[model samples]
Target: MAFRYLVGRGKDRILVDTGNGNAEYIQAFQSILSTRDLTLSKILVTHLHPAHAGGLDPLSRVTWVSSPTIMKHGHSPRGFPNLTSIKYTSLTDGIIIQTSDGDTTLKVLHTPGHTRDSIVFRLSEEDAIITGDTLVPHDGAASVVLEDPVAYLASLRRLDALFPKLAYPGHGDVVVPATDLIKRSIEEQMQLPERIIEALCSGGGIMDARDMVRRLIADAPEEARRNFTGTVLQHLLELEKRGKVRKRSVPKRVPSAAYEERDPDRIKGPGGLTLAQVSKLVKESRAKDDKVYGLKPVEKSQEKGKDFSGAESGKSGKLERSEVVQLHPAHRELEPLVEVVWSVV
Candidate 1:
């Protein structure tokens, strides 16, 4: 989770990234709001990822503000009300916030690698920067999977020159000696494209995003693979955006489509399957209706690859990295399965 700051004066309060829509997140946010007795004046969403912007659904009464570039997506989670999007708000560098108690300005540094609208807020008074997934204090590698390496590299360099002391990120502890932290983060992120290009240039042989993720971090634990894969997709998408890679070559899935296909309602799973695909899997699992009765894979005798079932029986469904065969759900179960996937996506 990225750390969000509440910077305002007197009675007004600004809520940063609402976190997710889970019980823990909702309770925490409610507690915080109750303690401060603050009604959300402005909700600043750094980007539209679920972990950062998922909580906006509950705070529908507030004015939601986001980069003009991101505003086109409309309010997140789809059905929220009182949504107001502001664009063409030339927030290239520092932006000033006018309040009754003078000015509480924030330096809006648009760092594009993590996401197109990803920004880092710098508070001069505290000498602290709010790095939204761009720089983590520990074990925090820039989310390269779906990021633009070129823009990301530039963003890192800019951060290095701007602040030299400390950084408070979306998650984890604060980073001291900010210059060093920025340098290392940039260096590490810069290598991602090169590595991918190398693997592609070598014998990796036109691997998809998922394959590249597995190859990039072979030694990482299975539990962490999904996250690492997501980060890798961020990089790949950015590369595609830069013309360094081709989008047509990438696999067509539903989850990535929420952003890639420009359809925010759909969610893509980390397994390279789209939300629609996952829903299909779950529907075929129950084998209830005649539609689901014949939901088996097209080829049963083919030993070339594993078949995908709508659902995995027992605890195997919970396994993060497994290649075992499972059952798909019945047609009736499709909607619920999709809902579950969307809740996470």
Candidate 2:
């Protein structure tokens, strides 16, 4: 259910991100073309996701433009049925599109992380940006489904830096003051890692991703649960990279591995917030008048220490704060916090 846009001046028309390849979408697009007196000339895909690229087959005669990264994966031929007639163009950071008369121009911005191939089209003439799922505006808030938390956050910051006057996102109504929405999205994402840490710490020191998802969005509708789970997992992976948390691989008999807080006393997170500060902020955000969601830590079982190692019986092992090494190169700039001493049973 992604939105596709038709941009044109005179007879030169460009289609942005085709919707699902349903016959209805094709008919509707044709009707729009007929009503507007604009012929389909080219397609600009934001990403290679099915809902966004599905209609490419029907419009195969036109020139297609997308991320070079996506093209390497053979999206043009395998994903679209009629690649024989389509002329594929790979775009990077600075590709520009000019109308035949040269009045309107659209610049491509490589903004990956909703997918590795996501891009945004910026129409400076209109002060608008056609953002794919890389940045979405929903209910006066920006939403994102991140494939990589670090990349996604960086992309959001990049969009904010652009200071677009308006945003025509892939889904939802056009957002005014687009930079503000991007900023809000960044703030929300920044808080997610801390929220995950707090959730893990509150749940008797460790919990699997599924358990964290359930606790975080206990009241969310069924459709939203899957997306929330993905967000939780992404944050956990990032936290693990920062050495704020560690993943304990469970035996094959278990469905998922458990994630444990590396340091319960002083949980480090993005923006230098400790666990207590993050918990307070979360509680304040959810508070109504004097009422706030109670963040009581779940009762710790006698087996809490044993569970940390993912073994039935073992003394919990500890690593000196200085000895902890970050495996992810992206987190090299992140400074490890104070000494972490894990208690043994």
Candidate 3:
């Protein structure tokens, strides 16, 4: 979910972060503008993500304002593809747009981390700030998608320095006593690294992201799985940066150059044991009373057979027709050495 705000009175409406591109939202926006008799003069996007800027093309006639960094990086057009003739204005830190007479202005604050192009707009007149996904209110706590956790923490500190009276987040109720909420968010973020380390320790020092998620945040709602995984990855990256953790690649069997040369035709087609051979191996293992896991006998219907015919020079220098077994999709290049292998649980 996304929240877009309409600020200012009739004829001077300023829109902040267009909602996700959907017909229902577009109709709702039109209805609001018609009911209030307001004309949208400008659109401000906090970041370049689809949820925040997907509807930009629909409102292309108005002046679109965003961070100069985002424009320089060419993220705007990619986010709003249909906006062929965009009227974009670059906003820098401390730049102010007057929202009302007598010194009322909205100030721009570059807060990168949720994304490299993230920014927050502070309406000093109302003692409020519009933070788009930089700080999200969730489960009586606040969280952020940390594209750069270090930068994210710094940005949070920057907001805390402002001591905003109210915080308008991208996907929740406005936070009152905004300083307290900011502090809570900072505290939660600070604990993430330790939490991740604890999860790793409990799993005997090495665990893939999915396993870590299941162990550390199994109680989290299903809808929150994506955010939890993102958070875990952020912490894992930070730990790796500090040399406390290392990422390893899973091993895969590859065909050796010598093997490929020796059996070029066999390598060309599917190269695996036949169903009969697999069944024989399985039966032998069961007779020995070995506990095998992740082993299943191939069904006849699932097997694909192919016939290849070719001519190759024989040892006597005579051309002769040769037939080779076609390779199956699962075992195209590598030779099938074993029917199944067991991993330690």
Candidate 4:
């Protein structure tokens, strides 16, 4: 939270990001409000994740404010703390919060990265920014949380350009010199493409998302594994945009468990991808209420150097990097270190 005082308008105080819906968590928040003699006038959540918006069911008597993403997906995939109560006021970029005697204002900026609805509150008067999961102190808040590393990179750069003197992240230990921290985070993010190339070069064979994690983020904290996964994926997407990476063409089913065409949602191809022809068959199979199935691909037959899934990488599901392209000039020295080519699915 940027400022406890900025939570509400006038004299009444508001809550930001309801903790969890559990009894212990609810009590902790109540304890704070009671001790402070603060009337809960409103609540503002960054994203509707269980951890951030879970306490809504028990503590959401007051009005709430959040991005439109909240209004669209009321609850997360976990389905805890049904967000059926209290319609939230949708927030957009450049909106101002009238918090005080007409002198104080809190500006909201849509910073989508950690999650689509992730946002930050910029308290210009205080020279501080309340960054939700969008800008955490450690691991950049990546988890099961779906992140668009491309959008994430742009959001981080935006935050860096607006780098304030103080930053309060959604998680992780608090630190000082927030500007420096944001810079370090951006630099780390920018270097991922090269790191990915290095990881692929070292493997020298077909790799999958799991393999990428094992090789690239080997020393990462256990909790941050998902975050690193999203991070690598983000860079991979960017590299694909630059024509440096490509997804492995999915293969035709061979009647195996992993590749059984009859299996629900099973798509097999190069790097374990589902090419267009394969995807069409899957769709057509499900559409047919009848048990009749389409003709299966000849055992081990391929599309003959094709993307089978016809997906633009990251859209049709997990993508594999079949080859690596040089990322930058300064890193050219490492190119020679890559003796063999590789692929990832």
Candidate 5:
């Protein structure tokens, strides 16, 4: 199914994240909108994920728009030509889009970690934020996947500053205390890079992204590990792009044989290594029964004076870190570190 929303002041029917794929997804989307007696005027893509944007194919007459980053990826669906215009709109930070119902302010917070163009639009008057993959709520935690951690962190801070009343994500239920959720999301994200850097400093040295994910998975809770895998990988990819860590291969790939890798043992420290090399290290290390360095837990801070401090004491900031933990499909040992990471963050 696709996720479409009626947003803006006039309830100006704009479909967000048009679940673009087969006709079935689109049919379901239209069916739902029909039930509400609403017709979409425009399609605002949250990002480029197939599930979120797949419904665009079935939307024959609507205008489709998204961040410039998504436009860069190019549109390929058969029905794309039917779209009035699949234009790229630069969502200026803090800019607001006025609708008939009320002003649906477009606080263009570029949260790029999940993808280069990922953004969260905060509707100030409504006290709600339209968070793409930028914020996923799970087990009372705010989880995020980023294409650019720096950008993602900045966006989180902006959201935390705005403290929206609620968050309606691309997927899942709406978050009621949007401000708190944003805060937790930020805190959770802040903990990841620190863990990676810490592992490197503590003789863990530089490591490949997959190994880093492996370490995290061993420590995370069973249910959360898979999500953690994607989260950590996204963080690692961002780090690699930033030159914080090096990869063995320019375009890394996993071999059919191995599950993990390390930076220090297989490649030059501060240099780089490939996924294959890292996987070798993981296999050898497993043979030796050694623990891989992983994310350390972030300590929860108490907001002594805020009205919500008591309920939020020891709770994660903007995004919940715990919910992001999930084991990589192959590496099973990183669960504990995941737990530690969530507990602290």
Candidate 6:
């Protein structure tokens, strides 16, 4: 889910993020301000991501503000799935916007992690931070799609040092005692290196980064899958730098062996249909998402007539595509991803 935040002082008003481009959501935002007699004068987006700034086009007449990174790339960062068409001013770190006779202040903190343009606004009056995707709730941590894991950790550390008490994230409700979440995010990231090493110990091979990503994502959810490789790749780079793991080739994109079972029957979505069938339903449905639970792999004795999706497979199969598959609605929206965990190093 996406979110739009309304921050105002007296009659002067603004929005923190624009949610999706959903017309109803935007109308409700405007209507809320109308009943309160506040005009939507300015919009400060944490980033130019469609989910956060999609309404910038429809909600004309408002001055827009975002990070220079968004404007620098022509509002279209490379690899960003959907970019918004918006003309916006650039925001910098530690800049404060004093609202309405200077009683309440918006402290714009340029905290880039999830995206190069991500930022946070600290409402001085309530000591609440509007953290757009930078520091999302863990239970709601699907929003933590990392661009650069190194920078992400640094940003989280900076937020930790600030001693924030409350947070309003990009996709979730208020995060009380925001420092706890910040520290937890930091802890999770720091442990990623160890996790990768442990995964490596589970198997043996001179593996490329792409294959390594497949191994790491065996237990990841659909939401976590998007940012999974980028996060894993960056940490692998770190591990290599420390001599914990070494690359096999000069970073050429070569074919890798299958790391997981790919039984077609195992890959299911809405109503437990195949991915292809789910794609059709997704185009016709308005469901954002629903709870998707997975079951453990079926016993080896039950594996018959099940070729590896399109290949032949036999015993010691850790899982079937169906047993560990997570059926969710939104996976259909993404393109088929065969990402490069390493940039052809």
Candidates in order have lDDT scores of 0.51, 0.58, 0.57, 0.54, 0.50, 0.57
Residue 283, model 6: lDDT of: 24
Clashing pairs in 3: 269-327, 270-326, 270-327, 270-328
State each candidate's clash count. 31, 0, 4, 14, 59, 2
Candidate 4: misplaced stretches above 4 Å?
A: 1-10, 31-35, 61-82, 139-146, 221-223, 250-345
What TM-score does candidate 1 reach?
A: 0.54
For residue 304, model 1's alpha carbon misses the true position, in angstroms, by: 8.3
Q: Write the per-residue lDDT of candidate 4 for residues 1-345, one digit (tens) a residue.
A: 222222543455545676666777667666765577655544677766667776666664433232112222232322233454666677678787654345445687888766667777787777787776777766533332445666777888998888698887777655466788888777876777777876655554343343455565555655465445545555666676787766553332212232233342554454454444444543343233122322222132222221233545334332233233232221233333221212533
Worst 10 residues of 1 by lDDT: 336-345
Q: Give the TM-score of candidate 6.
A: 0.65
lDDT by residue for model 6 (113-209), tens:
6777778888988978888888877652333557667788898998898788899888666889999899889988887887777655433323333
RMSD in angstroms, candidate 2? Answer: 10.7
Per-prediction TM-score: 0.54, 0.66, 0.63, 0.62, 0.56, 0.65
Query: Candidate 2 lDDT, tens digit per residue, 135-220?
Result: 77753211345557787789889888888999998888888988888988888888877776776666545445544655566556
In terms of TM-score, which candidate is stronger, 1 or 3?
Answer: 3
Query: Could you give me the TM-score of model 4 versus the true structure?
Result: 0.62
RMSD of each: 14.7, 10.7, 11.9, 13.8, 16.0, 12.5
Where model 6 places Cα greater than 4 Å from the true spot, the runs are 61-77, 81-86, 139-143, 208-217, 250-345
Question: Of 3 and 4, which scores higher on lDDT?
Answer: 3
Candidate 6 residue pairs in backbone clash: 266-321, 266-322
Between prediction 3 and prediction 6, which has the larger TM-score? 6
- Ranking of all predicted structures according to TM-score, beginning with the best and ending with the worst: 2, 6, 3, 4, 5, 1
